[model samples]
Target: MTAPLRPLVRIEGDTLVVPGLVSAHSHAFQRALRGTTQRAAQTGTFWSWRDAMYRLADTLTPETIADISRRAFEELRASGVTAVGEFHYVHHQADGTPYADRTALADAVIGAALDAGLRITLLRTAYARAGAGRGPEGTQRRFSDGSVDDVLRDLDTLRTRWKHHPRVRIGVAPHSVRAVPASWITALHADAKAHAMPLHMHVAEVQGEVDACLAEHQRRPVELLAELGVLDARFVAVHATVLASHEARMLGEARAFVCVCPTTERDLGDGLPDLTALRDAGARLCTGVDSHVLSDPIEEARALEMHERLRLRRRVTFTPDRGRTPAEQLLVDASVHGALACGWDVVNGDRETSWRPSTRINLRARSLADVSRDDALDGLFYSGSAACVSGVDDAAE
Candidate 1:
C-alpha cells in the first residue's frame, strides 16, 4: 500500500524553520565606515558622500578589511543571505604597489567569507585611473592599477590559483566609465569573454559621472557602453538610475541585469530608477545592499517597492494575490538573479540538497503567507524590513 504523503515541515520537538538569504552586491570594506561617515557636514549627494567613502577606503589594512568582511558576512548570513558578491576594489598598498602575492586583499575577503560560513564571489575591480591620463587622485590611489592588462593578468592569476576552491569564485569589474577609458572597456570585455567570467560596473550613478562620460564620449554612460559593445547579458550594471528611455530599453534588449540598491540610494540621496518600467521593458532586476549603510535585504527590497509606489503614488506595489508581489519579485531578485549575478548556483527543489541546510528557504511565515503566493508580492517589497526576518533553518543537515 502507498504510504500517506508527508507534510513538508518536520516536527522535531516543535521548532519552525526557514531558508537562507543571499546578497547580490556588497562593498564589504564599506561596513567599516557606516557610523563614521554619516556625520560629515557636506550635502550628501552620491559624489559628496563619496568623499566620506574615500576617507574610509584610505584607512583599511588587509587585516582590518578581512575582519570587517568576516563580520559583515556573518551579519548577512544571520539575516538569511547564504551567499554574497563582494564588489571589491581596494587592491594594493596606499602607495599603489601590488601586494607581494598581488591577490592579497581579495584573498583576505574570501578567507573572511569562509570563516563566516558563507559562499563568496570576489568581483575584483579594475580601476585604471580617475580620468584620461590622470593618475588616481588622493585616496583613490589604492583602488587603481597601472594598466588594464595588468588588472586582467592579476585577475587571471587569482582565478587560476583559486579556481579549485569550493566556495570562492572570481569575477571582473571595471570600476566605472569615468574611472577607465573606452579602449579599456573594450579590452576588458574581451578579457571577460576569454575568461568566461561575469562583468559588473557602476553605471549612471551620479550626474557628474553621466555628464563627464557624455562630455568625453559624446554619449551617455549607458549609450557609450552600448556603442562599445560592452553591454550584454553577462554584465551587471549597478545603479542604472540616470538612464533615459532609450538606455533603459537598451538594457532590457541586451538581457543585462540591473542591481538597484534602494536603501543605499535613498541614504546617499542618489535618484531612484523606474523598476516596474524596466521590468516591463524586459530587463532583469536584482537588489543590492550596496554600501552596507543598512545591511538589511528586507529594507532594500522595500525601497524598490516604495520607489514604485512614490513614482505612481499608489499603495500595494508588490501583490502576489493579483499577481506576483513586489516582495516576491524582490526576493527572487535577491535570491535567484542574486546568485547568478554573483556566480553562485541557484538551488531549486532537489538541487537544494547540495546547498547548506540554512540556505534552504521556507516561506511558511505569516508575513510570507498573508499574501498568497498567487497574490501580488508588493507588500514584502513595500513594507517589509529586516526585523521581519525571523531566522533561517538549519534543517536536514
Candidate 2:
C-alpha cells in the first residue's frame, strides 16, 4: 500500500496541489439542518429527523432556498469542492401545486451554485409516493410528480435552460424506492440513458428503508434495481450503507459508482457498507457531503478507511487495489471518482476548467507544520482539515 505520491499530490512552495474534490451527492437545502438535528430531542430516530427535514422543506421559497443553497455551495467551494451533485427534489410549492414557472426552484438552486463559483450537476429527482399504496402527503407532495413524463419534462426544461452553461450539468434521479415506485425508477433510468446523464439514487441508506424495500419488492434495494435492469456503469448509488455482500458484488460487477457519505450516514445512525467487498468485487468509490453535517472532504474521505477500520476492528484493512497507496486511493475517492460519478472526465489534479478545478493544500498549515516531504501527503490527508486548503485554489466555477 505504498508508492511515490507525486501523481496524486505534489509539494510546491508551501502548498500541496492536487485534484479538486467533488461532493457527488448533496441536498444543498439540508445544510440548514446541520446543528439543529444534533441536540438531544425526544424523537431521536432517523424518521423523526426526516420529519424535521420535511418541515424545513415546507418553509423554502425560491429566494430563501437560493440564499441557503448559495451559502452551502460557497462553504463547499471553500472546502476544496470543485463540483457537486445536488440531488434536488423540492420541485413544487408547499401546497403540492406547480408554480407559474415550473423550474423556478431548480433554477434558484443552480443560480446559487453558479453564484458561489461551483460547477453543479443538478440531479433533478422524480418522487411519486410516500410508500406502497400511499399517496405523497405533507412536504413530499412538493417532491412528487404525477407521471414520469412530468418529471422528464422538468428535466428537459432544466437541460435546455442550462444547456450552454459551462459549469452546469443536468441529471435525473429517482429519489428512492420509498418515495418513487418501480415504474418511475425504470423510466428515469431509461431517460438518463437516453441523455447519457449521470444517474444517482438513494439506495439502502437505513435499516428501515431496506426492510420496507424487502417487504414491498421481495428484494433488497440493490437487488430490486438489478432485477429491473437498472444496475450499470453510469449509475451512482448514494449511501449504500445497508447492503448484502452479494449486493456489493452486483454493483461491482457493473462497475457502478457507490457514493458513500460517511459523515452524513453516521450522523443518521445508518450502518456502514462493506466497502472492501465492493472494491474487491470491482465497484468504484466516491464521497459526498450529503447533510453538510460537516464540510470537510478530507475527513469525509478519511472516514471511509477509518470507519472500515472500526467495523473490522483491524488496522490497514484493505490492501491497495490499483497500484495506489491507501492515501492515494482515498484521495481518488474524494476527487476523481466523484467527478466521474457526476459524468465529468478527470485525468489529474492539474486540470482547471469550469468543472475541473485543481485544489491546493497549505503545507505550512498547523496540520502539517513539521511533516517531511516524503510524508506530506499522508499527514495532510490523515490529519488535515478544510482549513489547510490554500486560499488561492479554494473556489472553482
Candidate 3:
C-alpha cells in the first residue's frame, strides 16, 4: 500500500514558517494602563496596582473598548500572536447597569479582534462579588453580571452570534475564587461542560488571594476547585503562581493547563511560579501577556526559561526528558500548548485549517541575520524580538 501524501512544504524568500503564538490570557483594555500606571507611589503592591486598573476599567465605554481592543490586538498580531484568549470581565455599563443588548461590551471586543485580523476566544468572565463575602463596590460594578443565569444567558447570545464565524469562539471564566463563590464556579463549570467550552480562572496568583481563599474555604484556591470537581483537561488556571506542591500535582493529574503571564507577574511583584514542580507533576505549560505589560510572545517565552534559570541558579533548567531543547519546549508553550489552552484543536485537526491564524518570522532580520537555518528557532527565542515578526496571515480574521 502507498503511504499517505504529506502536505507539500515550501520556503519562500527569507521567511520561516512556524505555528502562530496563542496569547492564552489577555486583558486587552489594560493596554491603556501601561505608561499611566507606572508611578512608584501608586503601585507598590498587587492590590495597589489593581486599584489603578479599576480606575481605568471604570472609564471604558463601548467605543473606547473597541478602540483599545483593536489597538491591543493589532500590537499582538504584529508581535506574532495569531490568536488571543481575552479574559474580559468589564461587562456592565457604569453604575452596574446592563446595556440594552446585554453583550454590548463583549461585541465590541470581538469586533475589534476581527477588525485587527486575529482569531479570538472571548473568555466572557463572570464577576459576581468584589471578593469572597464582599459586595460589588465602585468600579467592580462594571464586571459583575449579577447572577450565574445572567452570565449564561449572555453567553448563549454570544454563541449564537458567532456560531458560524471560524475566527471567533467563546469560553467561560469565573473571574477567581475571590470574585465568585464556590457555587458560582460549579454552576459555570457545569454550563461549560454541557456546551463543550473552555473554562479559565485566576488561581493563586498572589499570597493575598491564597490567604483569602484559605480563610473562607479552609483550602487553597486550587484545592477548593479540585474538591468542587472543576479540575479537568478543559480547565485552565491562569496565573497559577503560588501553588503548593500537592496543588500542582492535582492540576497535573487532572491534565489541566496553567497559563503564566511572566511580564505582568514581574510588574505586579507576583512571585515566579514553581515551574519544576508543575512540570514534574505532568502539567502542560502555556504563556500569556495578561495585562499588556508587554506584547512580545518571544519575550514571554524567553522570560519563562529565564525565570526558571534565575530560580534554580542553573542554565537550561526546563529541558524535558523527551530530548527537545529548552528553546523548543518554550516555543511549544507559546504556540501549540497555548492554542490548546485556548480550545484550538492543535493536536488532532488539520494543521493548515485548525491553525488558521498563523505567523511568519523574518530570518533576514538583523537579530537573526547571522544564524543558520538549523538554529533559527533558538536564535528567534534567545536573540530575536518582536521586531523579527514580519507578516501574519490574514486568514485568522
Candidate 4:
C-alpha cells in the first residue's frame, strides 16, 4: 500500500517554517570592531569611529580575514541569517600593493562564508579615491584598485572563478560617492548593467557625506546618482538616512531598494530615515546588520519599526502593502526584499540552490510558545529575539 502524503505546513516538532533571513549589507571583518570601538570618549563621531576601523583594517591578512569572517558568518547563521551581501572592500597587501592572486582577500572571505554554511553574495567593491581629489592614504590604500578599468578586471576574474559556485554570487559596488568620482560611477553602472549584476553604493549615510557630494558634484548624493543614470531597480542605496523628499521620490520612481541598518545607524549616531516619505514615494525597504553591532535579524526589524514609531509619534507607522499586515511587512523586509537586494531569486518550492537559500525559526521557544499560527510572525518581530531561533539549516546549491 502507498503511504499517505505529509502536510507541507505541518508543525514539525516546535519549529516555525519561515523564509530564511537575509543580511543585505555587511562588513564581516568589522565584526571585530564591536567591543573595541564602543568606548564613549574615543567614538565621538562616525568619522572618529572610522579612524579606529581603518586601524583594524590595516591589520588584516588573508588568514586573519578568513578566521574573523568565518566567526562572523557563523554568528549570522545562528541568528537566522542564511544569506548575506558582504560588502567586502579590503584588498591588496599592506602598503598599497596588490597580492599575486589579486582577488586573494575576496577569495578568503567567500571561503569563510562557505565554511560557515551561509550563502554569500560578495559585493566586490571599487575604491578609486579617498575623496574627490584626494588619493587613498593609510588603510584606504588596501581598498583601491587605482582605476575603474582595474576594478572591472578584478570583477571579471572573480565572476569567472565563481561562475559555477552554487552558494556564491558576485555583484559590484562603487564604495561611495566620496570614494569614487562621477566617471567611475557611470562606468561601473554600465559594467554592472552589461553583466546583469546588482549594484550597491553608500548614499547619504551622514550629513557630512551629503555636504561633500553637494560641494563636489553640484548636487546631493542621490541626485547626482540619478543624474549619472545610476538609479534603478537593481540598485541598493545603503544607509540612506539623510535623503530629501525629492530624492526619495527619485529612488521610488526607479524602484530602487533602500537598505537601512537601524542598529548600526543608531550606534553611529546617524539620523533616522524618513520611512513615510520613502514608502509614499514608492521605494522598497530592506534591512541589514551593517558593522555587526548587533547580529540579530529580528532585532533589526524591530528597531526599524520602533524607530518609525518614535519619529512619527504614533503606532503602526508602517502599514502593509499588497495585502500583508505590518508584522508581515517587516518580516518581508528582513527576508524577501533582502534577498532581492543581494540579487537572490526567491522561489516557492523544496528545491534549493545558492540563489535560493532558506531559513526556519523555532516555534517551541518560550517566547513563541503561546503564539498561534496566525500571530506567530507578530510575536517574532514584536517580542522575540534571535535567541528564539533554535536551528538553522543550509541547503547546498
Q: Which one is best on lDDT?
A: 3
By lDDT, highest first, what's the ranking?
3, 2, 4, 1
TM-score, candidate number 3: 0.95
Q: What is the lDDT of residue 4 in candidate 4?
A: 42
Model 2 weakest 10-residue run by lDDT = 347-356
Residue 308 of model 2, lDDT score: 96
Worst 10 residues of 4 by lDDT: 348-357
Residue-level lDDT tens digits of model 1 in 162-260? 888877788888989999898888998898888777889998987888898878888999899999998887789998888888888888898788988
**RMSD each, Å:** 4.9, 3.4, 2.6, 4.1
Check candidate 2 and list the clashing pairs: none
For model 3, what is the alpha-carbon lDDT of residue 295? 91
lDDT of each: 0.74, 0.87, 0.87, 0.87
User: Candidate 4: lDDT over CA atoms?
Assistant: 0.87
Q: Which regions of candidate 2 fall more than 4 Å away from where they truly are?
A: 1-6, 348-355, 392-397
Model 3 has an lDDT value of 0.87
Model 2 Cα lDDT, one tens digit per residue, 1-397: 4322335666788888888888999999999987787776743878888988998999999999999999999999898888899999998999989989998999999999989888889999999999988999989999988899999899899989998888899998999988898998999899999998999999988888899998999999999999999999889999888889999999999989999999988888888888999889888899999989899898999898999999999988777765767887888788888888998765532221122467888888887999887887788778888989874353333
lDDT of 4 at 349: 18
Regarding TM-score, does 1 or 3 come out ahead? 3
- Candidate 4 TM-score over all chains jointly: 0.94
For model 4, name the residue pairs that clash.
20-359
Estimate the lDDT of model 1. 0.74
